[model samples]
Target: MTEQLLPENVQTWAQAPLPTAPPEPTPAGRLTIASVPAGHPYVRGISGADDGVVRLRDPLPDPADPDRWWPPVVLDAAWITQNADVVDVVHVHFGAESLPPGRLAGALDALDAAGLPLVYTAHDLTNPQLADQAPHEADLDLLISRASAVITLTDGAADEIARRWDRTAVVIPHPAIVAEGATPPPGRATGAFTVGVHLRDIRPGIDAVGSVRTLLAGLTDLRAAGVAAAGRVVVNDRVRDSDALDAVAALLTDRPDCVLVRRPRVADPELEQEVADLDVALLPYRHGTHSGWVELCHDLGVPVVGPRVGYAHEQHPDEFTAFEPDDGVSLARAVLAALARGTRPGSGERAALVQRRALARVVQHRAIVRAHTDVYRTVVRRTGASA
Candidate 1:
């Protein structure tokens, strides 16, 4: 049989069905699952899905506050306090931050009081900035110890938690949505044969600014090597004081040799489209365990460059070379080497390797959902669920 074709921009994957908790049997109770995401898009995305047990509203859309960590707790407490009987299980993915307001805590307490479970999936400090791991470990342990069951997206994350907390967590990697950047027309960049990229604000500290400065200096060297590059580095100055950004901006303001523009975060597709024009993507992060962005590039067959902090062992481990976070001299050589390599496909066959690998790396998330259903089954048996 011939293979059928689908639209390029279609989002083919979706959350799998919940088996443990069958659809509302008769007028029987519902599986009230309360969840909230770190970002507004995820919050709106998941909550709007008809599959959730207890749909939660999004919190304030501020992505810069260090204290705005427990967005789920805020969204959850609101639901449970007002309608405790409706929320059977509170499922949340967040880091170790203070719980929401007192009423919300009271609501969560009420759920526990009623024998409902609180399930938490840890995706916090995804790229931790703390100098010491002890505090981070403690915070994570505290949260997991309190949760009825814990879920994670990587074996790395599972190992990190089990080693410290003396408890195991189920591994479920994040899944992928469909990518439509198979073919782009005309010049790859603003100019012929040039590549463009954007590294949004690394964070709100001095070290992050220093990382940007080092990357800019490196891009300048790449331009000097004749690989014309035009891109921007978004800096969320609101995360810190204006003085911090002003100081960082000074370094780029004088550079006429390179086109180093600065801007804010944008929609996902806009960013992806920006990446599609480039032959390669540059991470240049000083710290982090893994990156979803790197996955984005590899999935689309767009080569990536950066320090070795992303999920290197799994995707393009040999394809990457590291550079000192704040050292301009070392970064300069690395950027030049990356720009010299070509990423254009020939006869629609070149990117096949990357396209296949990206799909394989992403399906792990679906496996995660299956594992979660198992946990739900165990919980159901213990709770005397008819299903």
Candidate 2:
């Protein structure tokens, strides 16, 4: 998609002059970071207790609803300017989607005025929540251009960043999602294959309805072939009453081969277990870059069937099977191919494997933390010396 021209006001702000005061010196000892929405699973996964980097507690946007952190306060230019003394650097991951181009430019301006180096992890080139890619590309154009350092999860993404923005991004592998020592639930029954598709709130990036239809079709074919197979379509309470839910329900009517399961949003552990139990986890995303869900499935040793949109297959090529987005036949074929590979190890062996994987991830997390720490220190040292 072509980059959208930023609004005139944002352009004007980008060229406008600001205060010329040097930022406060880096705090003694460990570096303090003001991460945008610091509580996200990805951020927590990469952080280590001994990494010598501390992420400030996320500011509550709503006092009554403490969990809501959208429109991250840290991204507010005023907040960055006021609290610039406490943080050595500002690292942004998600939550920029909450701000418009003008406001986001202002935040960059504030970082400049405060002399706080900005480290941005490019988690998504295209925001899945929006159908139009231009708005998100516009955001990327601004953030990537002004960021002091950039990071991405995969080589393909890093290359794309270079091609699109002429910026080099440090390629850091995504850290493990499931915490160590968390036991997954018992595996599903033998001789019966289960395919799962999670339509969490029906975001614009996900082809929820089409994905369900494709899985149902695939299940029908499997049953006809004398294979004992079932399909599970899961949706959260957020889309329980929406037209998307109604459409999905209509498609599943009288279709006993597939069942639609609805429930409230689940915590990370529970969600991990749910994914671990499936024979094949289907990612129904129509567009986006990278995937935490793919990583979750990989952590639990579940094979994934994902759309061929982003670098998800690159994350774990052996564990991922790609399909044409929104194509029922292609998705069905991919599901069959995934199942043909084989089911996960028996419960006893699988648990031991999971433990080993989790233990190894502890080491991986430390390395990821170290990589981030190095990036933070580089920017802070450069800025400090220049100041």
Model 2, which residues run further than 4 Å from truth? 1-27, 326-329, 340-342, 385-387
Looking at model 2, which ten-residue stretch has the lowest summed lDDT? 1-10
Task: Please provide, for model 1 over 250-272, each residue's C-alpha lDDT reduced to its tens digit, 9 standing for 90 to 100.
Answer: 76687654345455555555555
Find the candidate with the highest TM-score and give its number: 2
lDDT of each: 0.49, 0.77
lDDT of 2 by residue, 202-262 (tens): 7778788777777777777667767787788888877523887888999999998788889
TM-score of each: 0.66, 0.88
**In the order shown, what is each candidate's alpha-carbon RMSD?**
9.7, 5.8
